[model samples]
Target: MTISKRTLIIYLVSLGAFILAVFYFIKTNELRRALKLSEENRDSIIYALNQRSKKMSELDSLLLTGDYNSALKGYKDQLASSDSSSFDLIQQRIELTKKFIQQSRRVVNVDSVNQDTISMDTLAENTRRPTAEEIRNYDSLSFALRKYQIQLDRLKSQLQKKSYGEYLTFSSKKGNSVHYVGQVQNGKANGHGIALLNTGSRYEGEWKDNLRHGEGKFYWPDGEYYIGEYKDDLRSGVGTYYWPNGEKFVGEWQNDQRSGQGTFYNEKGEIVAKGVWKKDELVRVEEK
Candidate 1:
């Protein structure tokens, strides 16, 4: 029996409602994911800011106690420990620290202390009052102090560069392993850079708005090289790479693995290794 127009309309309306429900479910899940990521990033930023503020406050206390040396030490420690990804943010904080230090130095009133209390004049002048020509003779000391100032300026400049986009930061440990965390922008590594599992394996390459795109080289601690193309943080396209043990490969790579046609050679410059590599292993080896 044919359904009435009213009944047909009712069925169609119910189907439409079901479709809308599915759409709403997918949209809600996406929104939740976005919210979660936002919260995580917010927390990270807040934590970093709080830590810096606390350190700066400590420095202020040290200055009040007339512990300039200790205050400078604290400042250096914070500068070194700051998150590399937060170059811009940390740079602003560092500059603030510098301003505070400079202001404190100006108001230090070292003129009041005599030879009795650590010799304020000696500390301020760093020596007995020197004749004009004698002060000129202290060029070496002046040069050394200026050199330190230059280094501080350089770090400030680097942090200033971070304000533009995502960048990366890495540090080498005493054990010779590097710790990298950050992101990159345009053709540079921006944001938090990471160096994970230091087998001396490093990823120093170009990033397209934070994704690995274009050419890059992966260097192994043992002196092997993987020079090739990258897409979405994986190896892709044609590349020529050399192994640490004198083995070399020139071929196409896909998804961080060797694929398609390529050549492999041994240390003796002989065609001992030849084949298709899949997931870093040789799939087909053609003997010389």
Candidate 2:
């Protein structure tokens, strides 16, 4: 049978309209997806920018406060994570921090050395012989004086570096506070540095894994001090312990105790004892 012209024309027009609708729907969906993806990318970029800005602001604050250690750490972290374009700037910041730290250390070292020399001179000048009571109570008096000196030294150090405090302060597990100025690695005191304990004690020397290792000088608040070697935080190897009254012990040590061959001198610089030692006691006296 022959189809009507009107019917054929209507059917073709209807089919074209349906095809157009399907094409429009597909294109619209694709456009919506592209727009969503672009929005997500934009948000990510903004978040990253905000984070970078925050980090930079924190670094600036650390530098301004003279917290060089923290500032250096922050810069290093940034350098590790940043792109090549920022490498030069970050590296420069790291170098500047390092120089500042080195200069500060030099100043501290000179001041400490001068103070130590002066103290030694004063001790040398006191040539008065000890009385009966002074000799009998020398041990107790020396310990008390050393304790007092620790407090005094801590105060002095604080006053001297008030403006440019170039140290890191932290508290120990036992609620004691410690102020450290020096090289740090893996968040622990390492390399050369100085540590001031709240107990009126000070240590200046090499460290490893937060422990006193290698050579170092330890001072009490009083005029007593020790120059020695250490391992695992214990006094080891050769060392000298000096008292304010001009007495000194030079000897080998193990586990913080006097051991092996050693010499003990009186305030008059006379040798009181010279021999092998065990746990700080002279075991065998050698003829001088």
Candidate 3:
């Protein structure tokens, strides 16, 4: 078979064009795959960062509430679940919490001793009168207690500052101090956040227009705490209130008072009153 020169040249050109087209298509597909993989990796990294921030916030809440054991546990869990190299902050916090726990224990022990000594002195006074030596000893113990209390208070202040240092601080001439950290809109707290007061009180949860308008937890300096709904900066819904002495109230609230169906438990955890309450008083007792 004899072919023309022009015809042979045309066939070769077409074959070359087809091969180049196929190569271009393969490379384009590979490029698309790589881009998709890169996007996936970027999304994952963002998610991980968000999760870490949330965990750190939780730890901060625990610390502010003086829940050392819980804070320690949370830090440990985070460290265990994450790569240690990336969690140096968590490691440092764990150590800080341990020191705080030890200091708190010492304060508690001193307080216990003070209480025992007072009881003994009271009994002796009732029998007769405290001797000169006894009076001097009592004075010494009282002084010691005062010193220890001051130390504890200072430590608490330091802890609060460290935890809230990165937040916005507000101070007033009337000795009111508040530190807030979280979402802000229009120069006001508008979302989830934490607030700590100079009086050793703290609030963590939702905020609307700088008022506690949703669910939240409030902790007092004396170890009392409340967990429940909030409206307009007041306890306006169902909630649980716990006292330092082991008393508890679980029920409804209005304007920060117990104004609805609720149960009040004494220090022994026994229900002292279960009924309708009004203005912090049990108005009607419900038979159990």
48-124 per-residue lDDT for model 2 (tens digits): 54566578567745754558789999989988986654566566667656755654453331111111111122222
* After superposition, candidate 2 runs with Cα above 4 Å error: 1-166, 170-176
When sorted by TM-score, best at the front, the candidate numbers are 3, 2, 1
Q: By the TM-score metric, which is better: model 1 or model 3?
A: 3
Best by TM-score: 3
| Separate clash counts for every candidate | 19, 4, 0
- Give the per-residue lDDT of model 3 (tens digit) for 133-204: 544544554555456556544554443333322345565234577666655667777777767666656677
Ranking by lDDT: 3, 2, 1
Clashing pairs in 3: none
Give the whole-model CA lDDT for all candidates, comma-separated.
0.53, 0.66, 0.67
How far does residue 74 in candidate 2 sit from its true spot (Å)? 24
Q: Could you estimate the TM-score for every candidate? A: 0.35, 0.43, 0.48
As for model 2, its CA RMSD to the true structure in angstroms is 32.0
The residue ranges of model 1 lying beyond 4 angstroms of the native Cα positions read: 1-200, 209-211, 275-288
Candidate 3 lDDT (Cα, 0 to 1): 0.67
